[model samples]
Target: MGSTSKMKVLESLGPLLVACLGILGCTQAVTLEVKERNSTCIKAELSALLFITYTTFNSTSNVSTSLPDSTSVDAASSSCGAAGRPPWLVAVFGSGHALGLSFATNGSFYSVTNLTLQYNLSDTSLFPQSNGSGVVTVVSSSVGIWAPINTTYRCASPTTIRAGGAAVTFSAMRLEAYMPGNDLSPAESVCTADQTTTTAPPTTTTTAAPAPTPPGTPETGVFSVTNSSGTVCLLAKMGLQLNVSYVSQSQNKTVQELVNVNPNLTVTSGSCGGTTASLVLTQQTTTLNFTFSMNSTTSKYHLSGINLLANWSDMTAPFSASNTSLDYLRSTLGRSYMCNTEQTLLVVPAFSLNTFRLQVQPFGVTASQFAAAEECQLDQDQMLIPIIVGAALAGLVLIILIAYLIGRKRSHAGYQTI
Candidate 1:
């Protein structure tokens, strides 16, 4: 009897021990290899909760105010005049829970402003930038670095910022991406956004044709991407092909979809940052469908939602496949042929991956038409609310039915045959 009891105890504890080991193995930091070569771009997968600390230059108070983790205030209301309107400095961090922040900016600026971020979770401070004293003058179509702090961003002090008075010295803004739990909190990589002047292309009006390129017409093409190491990360020889289709609705003045889908993507002996491993989509497929809504008035193709299906391949510790739901906001011009280059951050449950650029060339014709505006609009709540309410009502009904049945059983027992 004693031996049997001991055997049962060990069996029950075996799975628990394995699970604990798995948790420990998975907590180590993950890095993404960022690559930008001409027009093609790719990066290692990332998944984690993201946080941000925004420091806005309060021109009215003549002091900079630090907003911890997605907090926002009005910039135009500040006494900084036009300088306080656009191009606010923002820091983004990722750790895993879901929250929402506004990335919509006024027409004059490229960056987002007037943010009142809200979240419901166990909040913790991940970034701590010391208070610094200084005033920086900014203007339209220029990049200025906020000043007066330690180079390592650890200690705070007064800062002096200056730029060219005659010609433009800086053309873009950059934000860094770093690994979690670093002692120095050093930035491993940087993402840059440039300011550019665009000329609107002339619009051509076409009368309705009897059967204008039937929508949802399936077209197939194969393209391959090779890394600097001479290893083929994506090869048509390795059974890779993209299937695309488009649908046009005339009355609604919208073009619904253009799906560029690839399946069974297998990577052999590929290096992601420092690790060389094989990558396989657990679902064995990846679909990037562009749902477009056209505005006839502006002659623009606004993106509605990007349907992405990404899962991890089978790998060992420090490398696991995480389910990902990517968010992207973009728009394009309405033209026969289009070529739009855009980048977005892919957020997963474990880490936030680096930026990657994607080019869409439809119908075997390559031309410039699509353009991307950095924005995020998610419908997570709209999809979740109905299910939550239904589940609560069903559970309440179940409890009442169970109580009624139990009461009847007790009443019958009370008048049992005596």
Candidate 2:
């Protein structure tokens, strides 16, 4: 009889034990949320997605000589741009070396700065289908500069880019990069000239060289620090409107470029967990806020907040915190991926970027607390099952006790009557 009772007890608890184990298994796969600042960098490597030709040149005091060697790199050979079309992504890598000694030949060096690539596309067929515009231009700044000896880099331009035509040729095209020594900013001149002009090519070239170089124009803007890796991740915008002119000695003319903040700006949030974050930005307001969420157990994080502001020098358009709207951009329930592991820099469309840093907000979740929290959450639903069983058992005991009392009362009455 005792063995039978023990078996019965074990059978009674079997289902409950299975339920608990099921809950534990589910907890292991919970989505992790991180609410605070932690550094994780995602590697972002861009492939060239266009048809490009590279011609090496050696400059001297008397005349500029172009090597007989010219190589045309077809974007179709690489893993970038749209299929069955010209390349859309233009990735350029630079290094510091003797410009006159190495670049003049086919050699590279250490410590290069301000590696940038600008693209201009005029052909209508090359125009991106999304934005039906005849002109497409993009510039990348503050790239591949931080390295001990040399840094090889790749950056993607804004989406839906088209470039080059048969008649329009980029003459004297060079890479514009600067080295630390002598403060001589190397300038790559991608001169756009019509191929139809059947004239003698000019011997003189306008290169970004040592001193007596073009005036260094410093531009400023505000960048939001939504998230970042351990290293500095910075993003800024064009805050001022200015038309600057440059003297092109090779062309013997003045060239002008315009820098202005978009009156209306739109930024699409990144996709995480099969969804996307999005916002519309404007220059009239200030103050941007950020909110983040972290799960200690899983070490996962998410962000939500309003009115997060990034301030920079010389903001021509008035931006006040009061007028600022905070509901522009947001982070999802958990981290899309780890930070500081080399990820793509998400930028608003139609704007050129130079450099900025992003540092994630710090939120720490401990293992002890994580387990406790998970247990509590599980108890909220499962606790009802145990409570109902306990209530039923108590009711059964009460009925039995009442029946025994009734029997005793009847027996006492019978004895009194006798």
Q: Please, what are the lDDT tens digits per residue for candidate 1 over residues 176-251?
A: 1111222223432121122234554455576754533423322233333334444343321112222222123232
Clashes of each: 15, 48
* TM-score on alpha carbons, each prediction: 0.18, 0.20
Task: Supply candidate 1's per-residue lDDT for 23.
Answer: 48
Best by TM-score: 2
Point to the candidate with the largest lDDT. 1
Q: Write the per-residue lDDT of candidate 2 for residues 154-263, one digit (tens) a residue.
A: 21111111111100111112222222232223332111121133454566766644323332333433333222122212222322332333443334444443334342
For model 1, what is the error of residue 264's alpha carbon versus the real structure, in angstroms, after optimal superposition? 12
Report the error of model 2 at residue 160, Å: 14
Give the C-alpha lDDT of model 2.
0.25
